[model samples]
Target: MAETLDILVIGGGINGTGIARDAAGRGLKVLLCEKADLAAATSSASSKLIHGGLRYLEYYEFGLVRKALIERETLLAAAPHIIKPMRFVLPHHRGLRPALLLRLGLFLYDHLGGRKVLPASKGLNLNRHPAGTPLKDEFTRGFEYSDCWVDDARLVVLNALDARERGAEILTRTTCAGARRNGGIWDVELQQADGSRKTYKTRALVNAAGPWVADVLNQVSPHSAKNKRMRLIKGSHIIVDKLFDGDHAYIFQNADGRIIFAIPYQDHFTLIGTTDVAYQGDLDTVSASDEETRYICAAASDYFKRAVVPADVRGTYSGVRPLYDDGSEDAASVTRDYVLNLDTADGAAPLLSVFGGKITTYRKLAEHVMSELQPLLGFSLKPWTARMALPGGDIPNADFDGFCGEMSTRYAWLPQPLLMRLLQAYGTRVDRLLGKAADTADLGEDFGGGLYEAELTYLKDTEWATCAEDVLWRRSKLGLHLPAAAHKKVADWFAKATEIAA
Candidate 1:
C-alpha cells in the first residue's frame, strides 16, 4: 500500500528541504527524499556566506542583490546559532575597477535591501587598519562591508529537521527512480541506498534536485517540455591555515576581472575559493584539480603580504552549480537568480522544476515555489516560515553569545571549547544531546575532540546521520580537527552500529 501525500519533493539540498519545510508548515502533507545525505552537494560546497552578492552589482543584478541582502537578516533571525555577522575588507586595486565604481557598488549593496540590522559600508585606509597587517604594502586603501557566514551543511540539516517536526517525511539516501502523472496524482517510484524500493503517490511533484534537476525531469517524463536546459558551472574551494588574525574576511580582485574570498573558517583555517570553470563531467566525480588549487593559492598570494602555495592547503571541495542556461558564454556571467519551470500542459498534475538559486535566498525561493503551486495543488494556506524558528534556533531573543554565557554556567563541567562547539552546532538542543550528563565520562565513550557516543546517537536517531562522513563533514566540520586514526575509529563504530541495528 502506498501513502498518498499532498506534495512529494525530490532532492534534499537547501532548496528542497526549505520547500519541504515551507509546505509542511502550510498544513500540506509533504515528503522529501534525497539521493544521499542532505546538503551532500552544492549546498554544502558554498563559499559559506549569506551576503548580497556585492560583485553581482557590477553586472547590474540589482534585483538579485537586493533579494539576497534582505535574506541576510531574515536568515540570521531564523538561525542565529549557525549564522553570524561577518565583515569583509575589499582592497582597492588600480588595475581593476575604479574606487569610485567600487564605492558605488557598496552604496547600492548597503541600501538596496532595506538596510537594517547590519552596519553600512565604509572606506578604509588599510595602512591604519588591523586587517592591513597581512595585506601587501601596495594596497593602501580598501572598502569594508557587512555579510553573514553560515554553517552551510548544518543549515540544510536544520531545515530537514524542521520539516520533519512539522509533519513532513524526510527520507535520506533515497532516490526517485521514476515519476509520472496518473489522473490527479503523481506516482513516484523511489529506490533506497540499500537497493530497496518503495512507491509513493502525491498530488504535486517538485524537482528541487540541485545539480541533478534536469536528469530528474527526464526520468519523470522523458520528452517533456522541460528538458536539457541547465548550465553546469563548477566552483572549487580550498581550505588553508588561518591567513590573518582578525575575525574579518578579505575579498581580492584577480587581474582577470573575477573576485576571490579569503575568509576565516572553523577558527583554525582560512577558506579560499572559488574558480569558475565550465564543467561537463559527472557531478558525483567532481573534485578540485591541481590547476584550481594553484590558481586559488596564487590569487590569494597576490594580495596578502604572506605568500600562499599549494602546501598551505589543508582541504579542498568542489560543487557544480546548475544555473539556468540563458545562452550565457561565461560561467561567472550567468545570473544566480532562480527560475521555476512549471509544466502542467493538457490539464495534468503539476511538476515544478527548480533551476538556478544561491544559498542566501533559499527561503525566499521556497516561499515563491509554494506560491506558484498553491492554486494548482488546491492549497489555500498562507506562508508562515518567515516568522518561524528553525530547529534549535530559538535562542534567547536570538542572542547566541548571551545564550552561550548562560549555557556555560549550566554545564560548567564541560570543557570551554567543547561547550562552545556544542552550543554553536546544536544551540538549545545541546541539552537534549547531553541529557543527564554531569561530566565527560557521563556522555559516553569519547571519540576525541569532544565527539562522544551520545552526540553520534542523537545525530543518527534525529538528524538522519548514518555514517561517519555525515557526522564529521556535514552535520559538523569536526573531521578537520580529529586525528587520522579517529576517522577509522568512527567509521568502525558506525559499521558495528549498523550491524546491531539490523
Candidate 2:
C-alpha cells in the first residue's frame, strides 16, 4: 500500500487546479495530474473575460450571473496584474432588443453582485463616443458596461503554483489511468508521459476533467450510470488584424439573438468569436471549422464599418465545453452552471465528478467542493482562498499600475514595452527572472519581440512549460507577435533544454 493522499484531483484545468489549491490550503495532502501541459485545452481556449455572463440573463440564471458578477471583483482584486477592468460597448440594434430592456438588464447586472470596484453601466451615444469610430454609421446609440479580462492560462498556472507551494503534487504530462477502492482509500493508477506507471492511495478523488468528464466517470466508476451525463458544446473563435483602435471591446447582437464579442487581443490584433454548436466529434482534435470561421467573421462584419473576410483571419482556436445536460436540445440554451456529483456508494471511497463550470466561477466551485468533502475528509479548516492572493498577486492593495511604476524605476535600463510585458505576465515575480542582471545582454538570446532566454528559462523551471506552444501561446501570447522563423528557434531551444536536463 502506498502512502495515502487526502485528495487526488484528476485534471489540470481551471476547476481542477482551483480545487487542488483550495484543498492544499486547507491542510489536506493533495495530488493533481494532467494528461498534457497545464491549461492546454479548454482553460486556455476561453473568451478570456471575467465578467458575469450578461447574455445569460435571457435564461433567467440570476443566481449564476450574480455569483459570477461577484467573482469578477474578487478575481480582479486577487490578481490585479493579470485581471483588470475593461469596458464593453453594446450597440443597440433598432429592430432587435429595445434600449429600455437593455438598460434594465444592465441595471440588474450592475447591482446584482454588489459591484464596488468597477463603475456602473451607462447609456452611450455612439456618434459621440470614441468606441463608435469602428462601428457602422447606423449604430447611433449604445451602452457601455464593465467587465474584466484575464490571462486564463496563467490563472491556472498560478493556482497550480500556489497548490505546489502549499504541499500539493502537481504532475503535468501525467494521466489518471484508473482507480479502485482499497478498503477505505482509493488505489489510483497514473501513467506518465514517458510510459512509466505509478500508483497512489487517496481518500477522495475529484474528476474535474472538463470536456472528458464523462470519460473519467466511465473509466473509473463504470457502475455509476448517474455520473455519465454531459453535453459537449463546441465554441470557436477567430483572431484578425486590429479591427478597432481603442481598448474597448464591442458586443454585437446577431439576428438570431446570439451576441458575439470583438475584443482587442495581443495589442496588435482583434479577437472575435464564439459560435455555439453541438459537438459530437473527437475532443482531442477540436478546431475552428471553416463554417465557424465564416460565422465569426460575418458576425464581426455585421457591426464594424470595415468588413472582415476569411483572408483577414490571422488565427483560430476552438474548445468543447462539457456542460451539464439539463434536457435541453439547443446547444446554446444549455446551462453554464456547474453540478457536483459526490459518489459514496455503500461506504466506498468518495469520488466527486465536476461538470459545466465557467472560468469566472471556478474559485467558488472549488470552495463548494471543499465544503462538500469537509466531513468525509475530516477537515475543519475554514475557506481561505477568497481572501488570499495567487502567486505574484501580492502587490500592496492590488494596485497594479503603482507596482508597474515601481518596477520601471527598478529596471530603468530595460525598454518600456519589454518591462510592461514582464510586469503584466509575471507581476512582482519579474525580479526572479531578471535576477541581478543589469542590461538586455545579460538576458541571453532574444527570440525577437521581447522574448528572451531568461524568461523562457523561468517558464521552463517554475511554470512546467515543456514545449514552444506551452510557453508561446498559453504562458503568453507572444506566438502571435513573433515572426514565423522564431518558432523553430524557440522549439530548438526547448529540445536542447530538455536534452540537457535529461
| Residues 1-502 of candidate 1: C-alpha lDDT, one tens digit per residue | 7668999999999999999999999989999999999999999999999999998987788999999999999899889999999999999998888999999989888999997789999999989999889999999999999999999999999999999989999999998988878988899999998999888999899999998998998888777665678888999999999988989999999998789999999899999999898888888988999999999999999998889999888999999898888777878888889989988867788899999999999999999999999888888889888888888899867999999999999999999999999998998999999999999999887999889999999999999999999999999999999998998888998899999999
Task: Give lDDT tens digits, candidate 2, residues 276-373.
Answer: 99988998899999999999888888888999999998999998898999998778889999999999877779999999999999999999999999
**Candidate 1: Cα lDDT at 344:** 82
Please estimate how well model 2 matches the true structure, expressed as its whole-model Cα lDDT. Answer: 0.93
Name the lDDT value of residue 71 in candidate 2. 98
Q: Give the Cα lDDT of each candidate.
A: 0.92, 0.93
Clashing pairs in 1: none
Number of clashing pairs per prediction, in order: 0, 0
Candidate 1 residue-wise lDDT at 136 = 91
- Report the lDDT of model 2 for residue 398: 94
